[model samples]
Target: MDVPGPERRLAAVLAADMVGFSRLMEADETGTLARLKTHRIELIDPAIAKNRGRIIKTTGDGMLVEFHSIVDAVLCATEVQHRMMRRNSDVSPARWIQFRIGINLGDVIVEGDDIFGDGVNVAARLETLAEPGGICVSSAVRDQLGERLDGVEFEDIGEQIVKNIARPIRVFRVRLQQDARSPPDKMADTVAQIGRKPSIAVLPLVNMSGDQEQEFFADGLTEDVITELSRFHDLLVISRNSSFVYKGKAVKVQEVARELGVDYLLEGSVRKVGDRIRVTVQLIDAESDRHIWAERYDRKLEDVFAIQDEITCAIVATMAGRVEAATHDRAKRKPTDNMAAYECVLAAKVLHHRSAREDNAQALRLLDRALALDPNYAHAHAWKGCVLGQTWVYNWCEDRDATFQQVAAELETALALDDNDSDVHRILAAVNLNREDHDKAAYHQERALALNPNYDLIVVQQGELLTWLGLPEEGIDWIKKAMRLNPYHPERFWNHLGRACYCAEKYAEAAEAFSRITRPDHTHHAFLAATFAQMGSAVAAAAHAAEVVKREPGFTVATYLATQHYKREIDRRRHEAGLLKAGLPA
Candidate 1:
């Protein structure tokens, strides 16, 4: 009973294959097949069923499954791996069977019982990319999983040139770590050891509304959640840049855990239609890939902040339990009573996050509108400070001093209104750093860090300030710590690290640090050029110099230094001199 017509729809595809299957078969074909059957029956099948996935087909050493939810597919994969590990614990190491799995979410052409198209091909390619006993996921699947799973680490393997695929496929490897079991300590009479607190990464919420324009709303909501949750001192929050790297990918929980060293994950999606918006959120155990909690909210566009608050509260509540009651209650305080003003602020923040000149201008305008609507809005003022600070730093404005003045005024007002706000402190630190008020910058940076020690951006900023203060060695140490906290940090962080290394006269390290960043922006290229020049690689320096010039035709040591918005005249002069020495023209 074969249907002749074509059936096309979006679906999550899970593909897995045994590692070294051919080699195992050559050694003992019958035994290998028998063991695989036993493993599938005893471990894989039940795990898949538990996660609500349907086994579609089996290809001797491989299996394909279909899931309605990407979360289920990831959970199934994690459980299967866990069970396999347990099963192999007692088996001989040489005889153990390991499987590599890949999950993808995309449109697939389904004809009766069979599936076809690039979706399946992507999944197969991912499976091939996965290391033995590891999981590889496409960007699509990772987006659907969202931030629900904590401590799952993802290593960006970058774009893969898959066979038959027109474009290179982005792949991520999920890092899962095994938990250690410890017996009660009886002989410890010395200082008490405080175990490290559990950590979580909130991946960027996917804009599932099909319209590309709704991306800002989704990203805004995600940033708000991150900000709200960061108020809790006990929980670690990965920066937007690091988590957003997993944007548009299918990732494994274990891999996420290993890469980010997080214990939990929170992922969600937003579907917006005019005045109405639907948000779906889930929290997952990164180790097990099991959904510990999940919720979906449908609300009017005006109530988006309320919905975000609720999601943030629930996640915090789950993590620290009743201990976070005060934190949860504090989170309920609205930034503004005027819904319109709040929406304006959201719009402004979304635009600001884009980091484009036009977007920053739009964001500043929206922030102005928000302030006009609600004069006493502390969060709006804080965000206004951020917008102005970013504008100056990113060379979005011609009058850099005026932008700094605006940032200083807005930040002071924000702090006066709500000194407890970590974001205000962070922005104030940036303003001070721009003014070369190193002491003040350090004070605000430390305050922000104290409010949320796990805030990776603040940590990075602190390192930057340290470097500007002539403490290049200390700056390198802090930046390295920040990198350790968020291994997948954006190119900017790596660029900062390279600059810090350059300041420390670690030219080789600087080159290596800059080399890690694949997406070289103007700043990255400038830093790479400087690093290569310092390393005596004139050819490499010339190559990156061309890239810098291409991005900013008028780019020179002076202009590049001016764009950085460094407050200290001494620091700016030193950096400019270094770049000039590295072959950058004045």
Candidate 2:
């Protein structure tokens, strides 16, 4: 027994893990598992084998491999990362399958298809430090691979104190340069082409309150920061929808900037503990992966607005050289002095976006509490109108007529309280559009646009308004711009685009746009039927017509046309004819 010693050898270890594995699994367990299997069979396993590496073990979302050569380990990791980026090009950013890989060269103990020691442990720790779709290596690995790989560079992140490691380990991030044969990173190039003004994206602030229910508070804070920054017209701010895709994900600042087409990124966390709140924010120059500015504020909960204002001013000053008086004034304006009311509004907003019947009811209750706490809160009133309008539009309430009237009253009260709130004007514009008050809708739309030109909701509504005003081509352009402003925009934007295309008599394009929706609802089916009918695809039109009727038996061309706010009689008649031609009851 004394003569029997464990086999020991020097080896290069690689640890790789999927980013946001738990989140992806929770979203779609079956699909995620299938995709993982496909990736392993098609790309990962083959790459490791090709690089002369042997997989020691694999967990549900991660793997550990041993390589004879440090150069082989580095080559395999970098190759997989770049290939993964290409594989994810067609996938939504939120659903992207990205990997974080780490490599180290150290002595290891080998035992029956498994290896153990500081080599494997260090690699695992380094993997945790790697960004999604990135690779990190310890100093030993970096030294071994010096000048071996062409078009590859190492970025020194300095020493990192990793978990369970007694001593600090020096870390280096692997950066790959673009090859001449490869296609350009369009979003990365967009940063330079978007004009001289700097572009920035505000990622959703992390909720550090130790309670999942408080996520809305952090989200509200992040949105308020984005809104404040957007008021500085000199800066191009990415919309909330596009920026929020990175929420709760481990992302590289460079990857995020490339994806969002922004020159800068603002990321932070919110910790609301007891009556005190702590906010930590950092402004990063994405291209250089450098922190342009950073700050931490510890204040009472009541001083949250002041903290936001300070953060906004600091960022503006750091990026643009200075903040204007108007921008400062705008950032300093608080929606409500009552903290409880602001929290209520924040919670309500999260519920409203869920679009569930129970969530809609809960949102209304929260808004009621908000109004009760501060009746003069313009945002609360405006949000109350939005919720009621949702109820009317989605048939969530029993008394549709009464809800519609209440919506108008709440919006009117909100506008009177604070005419400067962009959201108030945006909601009012929507209400007026639904009521066929084109002139009022136009005025509010203009006001909303002027107040916050970067706001996606307002910009999209301009397209809707233009479409209804018989300017289909211009409406199409505006809609496309809105989509550009928020790449992860709601599916309804496609519906808007489809409708505008139909109005413009581009039936084929209209059909194509409608096809982009994963699950077409009854209204979507109706539009699709009309689009196909106009294109003389009678069979396709009839099939979609059947789907519409199956979903909503009472649906008819006359009733649908009656609800549409087409300013021109010709447009109305054209849509009516298409529906009838599609075999929809008139």
Candidate 3:
């Protein structure tokens, strides 16, 4: 009796090929072939057998394998990879036999111990996407083997438009353990990629001023120095949030270097007296824990900002000689003539970062005071707009329409005062996003990036903006770049990353991303709920849904969708469907 139709069943398909095999053979044909055969017989075959994966077929340099369990297939690939790494550890780089592997979980047509379908083609395409010694897997493979794969992390690489794939497939790079390799794809977007330029962190300057009220001045000086240092093309300045983690705590320079992953550390103290201001600064080699340079400046109070500029120029010249005129212009631009206004902005910035309602109110008041002192203060005006923009994000505004209008007005004034101010453009971009003005938002974002490419906040917002603009793949790259620039970035970065994951329809990755956030809010819980719902985990989805409602009782899918900034109607509909499945209020 003939079997009914062709046999079809879901299976894990793994495709792998040795990297540069042709070149290896061209260099040393006999030895290359012998080494390849020896590896297959000694390592690859045994690993496949142990993991219960069947070897379907093999070319001289590639193989297609099948497994009843996606987990087994992935495990086999990883085990083989580990053994290969150990075997090639002592081998010369030119003679190393690196393999790229790809796995997919899909329905396959079977006939007489052979299989063929889109599944195999997709796996082959994915194999080409991976690095010489890395693994790339389809989203389905990641979904099938979730957290069950211990010591492994599937970093979402976003939807890839591979050859012959009917649609873009969400792909993930499989990472084993803590050490991340510099694959070509990842290195392109990484700021700290292999052989980065000199990296430095400017620690918060200690306030040596007799009056406690002038502490803001000291903090402002540190921030200004950090900003000035960032303008230098050769220097990688750690973001303020990352550098300030050691504030008011006793710490060693080497410890800070280890924590922040920087090569240099700059420390200073600011002291103010009746008629004169004195500053002490020192640059330390973090790895050696030795002071490389030290300086002291005593200047009249009227020349405080100039003192900052001089100190910056000195540091830059010390770090890399021959500073450009444009660098001086960027480092020395005065925010406001009135020092009181500068202090007001510094105080408000601290409050703004807190993000609590009371803190927002305080920050708004300080920004108003700063603007009152100097109406043309572009930074103050920009921050005012940012505060208003946050009101919309955190649902703090009673009259959202009025708040949006006010935000637009403030940002416009800031732009008019100084178009080069990245913060002004960034705030305007956020305002445009809230108003659903996608093109304008993107334009402002591009301007922001142009003004300050290395600014962590601006860089990550580029990612967030792109994700909301229906280009999650590019957004993921930008966000990863931001992380690379600031290793100790704030927790909110993970939130943006998680949202990017969800936007790409990789729910398992999205849920894991949200879970890893240091502090999860209603939005985070809601995302987790939707992600779990997409994966058909009813219990997990219900639990996360409850968490969202528990945090905000009136939370509903409709309300949530209304607040989202997704440009495409289809994307919003997709998100809505997940929330609905999670039993969130419509």
Task: Report the number of the highest-lDDT candidate.
Answer: 2
TM-score of 3: 0.46
lDDT of 1 by residue, 1-586 (tens): 9777677888889999998888899999998987787566545786788788888899989988988888888878876775576556535688889999998998889877888887888898889888878899998777766688765657778889987788998888887654325423531321122223447888888898997867877887788777767675345678778888898999887898779988778888989878888888787777667776666777787766676665554444344332222222322353534335555665675566556788889888878887776676777899998988887777678897777787888986776455556678888887777675767778778778766555566778878888777787998987877665554454568778887887777878988888887656777778777777766788888888888878888777765675465445675665666576556678
Alpha carbon deviation, residue 362, candidate 2 (Å): 3.1
Better of 2 and 3 by lDDT: 2
lDDT of 3 by residue, 1-586 (tens): 9768888888899999999998999999998997787577546887788788899999989999999898898888887776677556535699999999999998889988889988888899999999877899999999888799777888899999988788999999998542465455534644232223457888998888877855777777778778766754345689899988888777888988998988778888888878878888887777667776677878787866676666554544444321222222322354534235555665666567666788888889878987876676778899999887777678798998888788888986776555556788788788878778898788778867766666677889999998998998888898987776555465778889888988998787788778877667888888888899999999999999999999999887887888898888988988899999999999
CA-lDDT, candidates in order: 0.73, 0.81, 0.79
Which of the two candidates, 1 or 2, achieves a greater TM-score against the reference?
2
Ordering by lDDT: 2, 3, 1
Which whole-number lDDT from 0 to 100 does residue 107 have in model 2?
Answer: 87
Model 1 CA lDDT for position 72: 83
Question: What tens-digit string does per-residue lDDT give for candidate 2 at 155-238?
Answer: 999999989999999999998643236546864564333223457898999998997755866887778777767664346789
